[model samples]
Target: MSAEEKKTRQMPKGGRKGGTIFPRIALQDAVGYARRLVSKTHTSRQPRDVIYSGVVGAKAGIGDVRISALKQYGFLDGDAKSGYTADELAKKIVAAPPEELPHLYGQAVLKPTVFKRLFDTFQSDTVTRAKLKQRAADLKVHPDETDTCVELYVASLATAGLVSVDGDRITHLASADMSETAAISVVTDENNQSLSNNSTVNSPATRIDAGSDTEAAASDIGEEDKNGFPVPPGNSAQPAPRANFNVNVTLDSSMDIEKLQKQLELLKRFGAI
Candidate 1:
């Protein structure tokens, strides 16, 4: 291949064009935009009006970079001309259950900047700014812009509640506490194995006669007796024990009856009579 072609091919995805890569903003900014967008009092307005309304906790004048971040991360919708509104995702964020919020937040944050790459690079409790810079470098970002990417990532994560900031230290948060919802069902098998998403546990004794049991097939739940059911190895009700035995018999035509009698006597001796 030509050297020029090879060089172009080697360029990192979303690599820097001028001094830095594509614009990025803090996580808090996106969260603020989301909060305002879903509030009952919120109305559709130009991006500038929303930013300056002081709902998102922006102390300084809102800039294009901040507005751009909201659009890129899917919090805001529309262009500079026709005005902006809350995107569908923002609505979901407001309505999503508390347990589901973390995953939703993760999806929102990973949409922009070096945050996604830096998030993947994190293998432990904390990720350093130096490490984030290295990730930016890998993305072919300019040395001057690496710090910008790192700062954006750190602030964004802190806003997302995925990490805690202590001066320079960035510590990742434990996974959000998730609980089962109406959309999801968890079940345990006879062996105490857990399954989710309406999964079923196969019963060893209950044979599912599919073609014959059409009515049973209509329901998702397993058929159970009104009282109770035995799992396996029979129920606790005491019953007489039974044994299976195999016996070999030999007969001769000449002395069949006498030989049969002798064999029967031997069977009695062996407790098989």
Candidate 2:
């Protein structure tokens, strides 16, 4: 080869692979390693290669075929993405499966910064009682209902090693030096109390006037005349006999008490009581 051509060939391709070199394993083998790490029996961490070999061995066995294919299928579901780094794969093979990973990323590899941010948010923003209250309000749930949702979110974050709880306080996985605002924003302004109140006010239950029947019954009873006493007939034995008074007060006072009681009972049964 010419000197110029040889010099050009000597130059490394793709700028020397950019960062640290990571060993690659077959998709099936990677899955098996992950499963073994997650299995209850395997407590110690195993290398990625060792896990892959185990997966291959398991696949060859009749009963183990289903398990062997699990990791492979899971990766294929995400379009052949292993979703884990070499070190992470090794750790997973020794520790647990991606499915059992407590965080949102599961067994998938994440940048250290990203993982740190996620954990920080989980700790400061997620665990605080105030933050939880805000979240519940934003979700339109009563404060009483916040515990369950917060617990679930915390559990998920724990799996990912993003946050840890100590009594009431949550310790983030990331360094304390990280920005607190990012974490604070997560639980802020999530309260839906206003929306909930509006919904309640607009609901059919509250909108209905329950005492309407009572008001209507009261109105049905005719109003008394302007005088302090009830108007009397001009021919009746009264001191003040108004010549223009023609309405009979005796007929008005003859209301059926029994009928009124029966109507009230019916209204009570109909939830208008």
Candidate 3:
């Protein structure tokens, strides 16, 4: 506990200022632990309740790692010294239908550093084991660490359906079933110009076929309006007025795949799913 010893302690290898660690537990384990924590009571005075209830033992510090994983994933909030407390988001996740837990955990676990790095680096359509190694090299990760990272990625995120990994190929889940906000409808005219909400729209006239009238040409004088136009009442009907709407989609072609992939992950982490 001396000043020099404190300086040497700095922080654990992969740990930040807080006790939280990048997630190490698989998706199922994380979800199961979260569900169990929801049924327990955690008070400010008894923050250890979470660790005690969810983790088996501190053997080799596995228990600490698991607790840290939970905290990193937002299931349990607070640090080791302060104990852990389950927040509203955790409660909702626990109460969510069993089928939906994987998806929820996927989003939450992606917040960890390891997973975030993997996601961001492999945002392309297909990422192989070689690609993973290349990414590791680019990030200055040790060759040995690359293998471990790939294994961890498969066990957690890929297994959770948050991503796809076939053999060595990896893909970002761009079309995942994520929740979207209500889009404002912009009414527009045929000229592609935005129109006011109160604007009136005149629908096109509906055309009807007259019964095989081969002799209708002989009745030109039989039905003629004051304007000298043929008045075929049964053959033509005015269409009802209706609102015309146009959805304006502006695509930024300059945006590359990596940037778009980051946005998708960002949406997931914020619970837009």
User: Which model scores highest in TM-score?
Assistant: 3
Q: For residues 86-124, could you state the per-residue lDDT of candidate 3 as single tens digits?
A: 766578786666555555666776777767777766554
- Candidate 2 off by > 4 Å: 1-130, 136-145, 175-273
Return the TM-score for candidate 3, rounded to 2 decimals.
Answer: 0.50
Return the lDDT, model 3, position 188.
Answer: 18
**Pairs of colliding residues, candidate 1:** 27-156
Candidate 3 segments exceeding 4 Å error: 1-21, 42-45, 53-60, 140-143, 175-273
The lDDT-based order of candidates, best leading, equals 1, 3, 2
lDDT of each: 0.61, 0.41, 0.58
- Whose lDDT is higher: candidate 1's or candidate 2's? 1
Candidate 2 per-residue lDDT over residues 1-273, each given as its tens digit: 788988777654562322211113323344444455455224444443443354334323432333333332232111113322223443444554443333223333232222223344454453564565454445444345445435544554454455667676665554443234334433332434455657776677776655587785554333434532232224536443223423222324677877666655544433344
Give stretches of model 1 more than 4 Å off: 1-24, 39-61, 123-127, 161-273
Worst 10 residues of 2 by lDDT: 76-85
Residue 184 error, candidate 1, Å: 8.6
* All candidates in order of TM-score, best leading: 3, 1, 2
Q: What's the count of clashing pairs in each model shown?
A: 1, 14, 0
True-structure lDDT of candidate 3 = 0.58
Which wins on lDDT, candidate 1 or candidate 3? 1
Please tell me which model should have the higher TM-score, number 1 or number 3. Answer: 3
Candidates in order, TM-scores: namely: 0.47, 0.23, 0.50
